[model samples]
Target chain A: MVVSVAHLGPPGTYAEAAALAYVNWLNQRGQQGLLCPCPSIAQTLRAAAQGQADVAVVPVENSVEGSVTTTLDTLWQLDKLQIQQAHVLPISHALLSRAETLEEIKTVYSHPQALAQCQGWLERFLPSVQLVPMNATTEALKYLGEDKTAAAIASSRAAQLYHLPILVCPINDYPDNYTRFWVLSLQPSGGGSHTSLAFSVPANVPGALVKPLEVFASRGINLSRIESRPTKRSLGDYLFFTDLEADAREASVQSALKELTAYTETLKIFGSYSIVSIGKL
Target chain B: MVVSVAHLGPPGTYAEAAALAYVNWLNQRGQQGLLCPCPSIAQTLRAAAQGQADVAVVPVENSVEGSVTTTLDTLWQLDKLQIQQAHVLPISHALLSRAETLEEIKTVYSHPQALAQCQGWLERFLPSVQLVPMNATTEALKYLGEDKTAAAIASSRAAQLYHLPILVCPINDYPDNYTRFWVLSLQPSGGGSHTSLAFSVPANVPGALVKPLEVFASRGINLSRIESRPTKRSLGDYLFFTDLEADAREASVQSALKELTAYTETLKIFGSYSIVSIGKL
Candidate 1:
C-alpha cells in the first residue's frame, strides 16, 4: 500500500520539505509514500487523525521561535494522533524577489514565524519595508513575479521551485536555526530513543508541577524540553508539553509513567520516536 | 516630573489602552504620568531602558496565546529594566468595518495574535476571507473606512476612536481571553506579591533543569508560570522564564533564588510586582 503523508503546503513550505524527507525515509524502508499538502498545520494534523492520510508531519518547535503553539495545542486536543518518528530540519531562509538589489524592495512577505526568524537581518537591511505575514512561505512567492518591490523569505528550494531570484541567502539571524517536526500516525510506533508527553497538574498547588518532573529526575531520565501553554480556560491556567530522553517501552519509563499519573490531572503519552536529522533542504 | 510611558501603539492598540490604564493607576497614587506610543513592543521596552520614558507598559502574556515572546525576549536582553507592576486586561475584540454584514467582508485585518484569538469564530463565519495581519490592530482601521469589503478586528474603543461601526463585539474564540502587561522602569521596585526571572542551564547535563526547580519546590514557593524559550544557539538549548508566587524581597524567595544560581549558568531577576486586574477597557 502507498503510505499517504499530509503536511502544511502549497508544495514548497518547510512542512512540505519535511514531509518529502519523511517519505524518502519511508521509501528506503520499503514503503511507498504519497504527499498530501494541506493549507494549514491544523488541517494537516486533522487529516491524519481522521485517516485521510497515513501520517502527518507537523512542526513542534523552532530554535528561534520556541514552541509551535498551534501544533502543540492541536496535538493535545487530538488524542488519536501518536508519534511514529521525528525529523530535525536545518532552516535556511533566502530573500526571493524580482528586484536585483535589497534596496529596491518595498515589502517582504512570508509566514509570520519566518519574518520573526529573520527579524534582526530585516532590521539592519530592509529596515523600512513593510513586512507582510502570509499563511505559508510559498504563498508569498506568487506575488514576487509581478511586483518589482516585493520579496519573500523562504527556503532555497522554494527559490528553485518558484523561479524567483535569491537576493540574499541564509538570511536567518542565527546560523544554528533548526525546526523539529513530528511524524504522527493513528497508531503508536513502540520503539524509539525519545518519548514526548503533555500533562496538566492540579491547579494552585505549591509543588504540583515539580512532582511530575521529579518522577523522571529521580529515575535519571533527562528531560529534553518542557514548555507551558495556557489551558485557554483562563490566564495562569496551563498545560505542559515535555520531551524526555528515554523510550516509553522501557520498564523504567513505564514505572515513571505510572507514578506520573498520580501527580497529573491529565496525562498523555504522545508515543516514542527516533530522531532523523536532515542535512540539507 | 511628567512621567513618560511608552507602549506599542498608534493610540488605539491594546498596548495603548494598557498604558492608559497604567497611567490612570499612577494618577490614583498622586503621580503625574505621560503616554509615549512606540511602533513596536521592543522599542517600548527600549524607551524605558534608554531613559526616553520613565516607564514602559508592554504585554507579557495572553490567555489564549500564552507568552508575548517578543516582550519576554526583549526584557531578557535589556538588563536595566525592572518590573514595577502588572495589569491584566480582559481582551474583547470587535469587528469594525463599513460593510453592513459579515458576508460583505472579503478581507479581514488585525494583528496576528488578534487573528489567532478569534480563529474559531473566523473559520466558522468568514472561512474564505483573506486574513491580513498588521503590526498593530489600529493599523488596519485606516483601510476599513475606504474599502467596503475590509474589516478589522480590534477593541470596541478602537471602533469609537476611529468612528467606525462595530459589526461584532467580543469575537475572540474564548470568552475568558485576557492579556497581561508589565510596567517596567529602570529601578527595581522593592515590594510586590510575585517575582519573575529567567535562567539558562549548562547544556546536555542530565537532570540539570530539575535542580533549579527543586530549589523553589523545596521551599514551598509556588510557580505560577514556567516557560522555556530557545536560547537561539541551537534547537534544544533553552532558557527558562518563570513567575513565582512569592516576592523577591521575601526571605524564602531570596533563599531559593540564591540556591537557584548554583544550578543555572546565568540568571536575571526581572523584579517583583503585584498584579492589577482591570474591569473594562
Candidate 2:
C-alpha cells in the first residue's frame, strides 16, 4: 500500500526535506510512501486530518525561534491527527541570487523564520536592502530567476534544486540552528519515549496550571517542553502544550493523564512519538 | 523634559498609533511625550534600554496571534527595561491600493501578522495574488504609488497618512482582533495590578517548573499568562515567561518571587504595569 504524506511545498522547502526523510524512514521499514505538497502548513496538516493524505509533516519547533505557533494552534484545532514521529533537521541557509556580490543585492526574500534567523547577517551586510517574507523559502526562488538584484535565503539544497548560484552560505545568525518536525497520522502509532499533549485550565483560577503540572511531577515524569498559546477568546485565556518524557501507553503516564482531567477544562493527547534524527540525510 | 517614546514605524504604522495614544495619555498627566520612530521592534525596545528613548511602546500580545515572540525574546534579553504600562488597541485592517476592484490586485503586501490575520479575506478575494510580507504594514504604502496591481493590508489610518485610496475596509478575518502593547521604561513603574517575569530552570530536572509555580499558587496569586521560549541552546531547553495578576511590589508577590529564586537558575521581574484601553483613539 502506498502511504501519502503531505507537506508545505512547491518543492525545495525544509518541510519537503523532512517529508522526504520520513518517507525514507518508512521505505526502510518496508512501506511505500508518496509525497503531496500544499501551499501552507495549515493545508498540509488538513490534508492528513481530512484523509487526503495518510500522514502530514509539519514543523513544530526551531532551536533559535522556539515553537511554530501555527503548527501548535492548528494541531489543537484538528482533533483527530496523532503524532506518529518527530524528526530533527539541522538548518543551514545560503544566499541564492544572480547578484555577484552582497552589495549589489537590492532585496532579500525568504520565509519569515529564515529572514529572522539571518537577521544579524543581513543587518551587518545588506543593512538597507528590503527583506521580503514569502510563504516558503522555495517560493522566493521563482522571483530570483529574473531579478539579478534579488536574493533568497534558503537551504543549499534549494539553490541546487532551483539552479540558483549561492553567493553566500550559512547566513543564519546562530551556528546551531535546528527545526523539529512532526509526522502526524490519523491513527495513533506504537510505543514511543515522548508524549505530547495540550490542555486548557478553568479560567480565573489561581495556579490553574499547577495541578496539571503536579500530575506529571508526582509521578516523576519529566516534561521536555511546555508552551502556552492564547485561546483567541481573550488575552489572558491560554491553551498549554507540553511534551512529557514518557510513553502514553505507560501505566504511570496513563494514570497521570487520568488524574489530570480533574484539573483541566479540556485535554488532548497527541499520541506517543519517538524521535528520528536525519543526520546527513 | 520631553519623554521620547520609541516605536516601530514610518508614519501610520500601528506602533506609531500606539505611540501617539501613549503620548496623549502622558500629555493628559501633564508630561511632555515625544515619539521616535524606529524601523523595527527590537530597535524600539533597544532604544529604551540604551537610553536613546525614555520609553518604548511595542506589541506584546495579540488576541488572534497570541504573544509576539520578538517582543518577549527581546525583553528577556534586555534586562534594564521594565514594564511601565500596557495599552490594548483594536486592530482593523484596510486594503489600500490604486486598484478599483479586488480582481486588479495581482499582489498583496502587509506585515506578516496582518497578512496572517487577513488570510481568509485574501484567499477568498485574491486567491492567486502573491502575498508579500513586509516589516511594517505601512512599509507597503510607498510601493503602491506606481503599482496599480498591488494592494496593501494596513490600517485605514495608514491609507489616510499615505494619501492612498482604501480599496476595502475591515480586511482582517477576525473583527475582534486586538493587540496589547507594552510601554517599557528604564525604571520600574508604580501601582500596577499585573506583574511580568521570566526565568530559566536548570536543565534535565523533573518538575523544574512545578515548585516555582507552587509559590504563586500557594500565595493565591493568579497567573494571567505563561509562554515558553527556547533558550536557543538546544531543542528541549526553554525559558518561561509568565504574567501574574498581582503587583510586583506587593508582599505576597515579593515572597513568592523570593521562593521562586530557589527553584530557578535565573529570574527577572519585569516590573508591574497597569492597563489602558485605546477605545477608538
Best-matching candidate per TM-score: 1
Per-prediction DockQ: 0.78, 0.72
lDDT of 2 by residue, B33-93 (tens): 9889998899999999999999999999898888898998899888889898899999999
Estimate the TM-score of every prediction: 0.97, 0.96
Give the range of the ten consecutive residues with the poorest summed lDDT in model 1 chain A.
A201-210
lDDT of 1 at A21: 96
Tens-place lDDT per residue, model 2, A124-154, is: 9999998888879998898897788999999
Q: Give one digit per residue, the lDDT tens place, for model 1 in A1-281.
A: 89999999988899999999999998999999999999788899999999999999999999999989999999988888999999999999999998978888999999889999999999999999988888889998887877889999999999998888888999999988899999999986766999999998876678878788889989989999999999999899999998999999899999999999999989998999899999953
Clashes in each model (backbone N, CA, C under 3 Å)?
A: 0, 0
| Residue B129 lDDT in candidate 1 | 96
Positional deviation of B204 in candidate 2, in angstroms?
Answer: 2.8
TM-score of 2: 0.96
> Could you tell me the TM-score of chain A in candidate 2?
0.97
- Per-chain TM-score of chain A in candidate 1 equals 0.98
Query: In model 2, which regions exceed 4 Å deviation?
Result: A146-148, B146-148
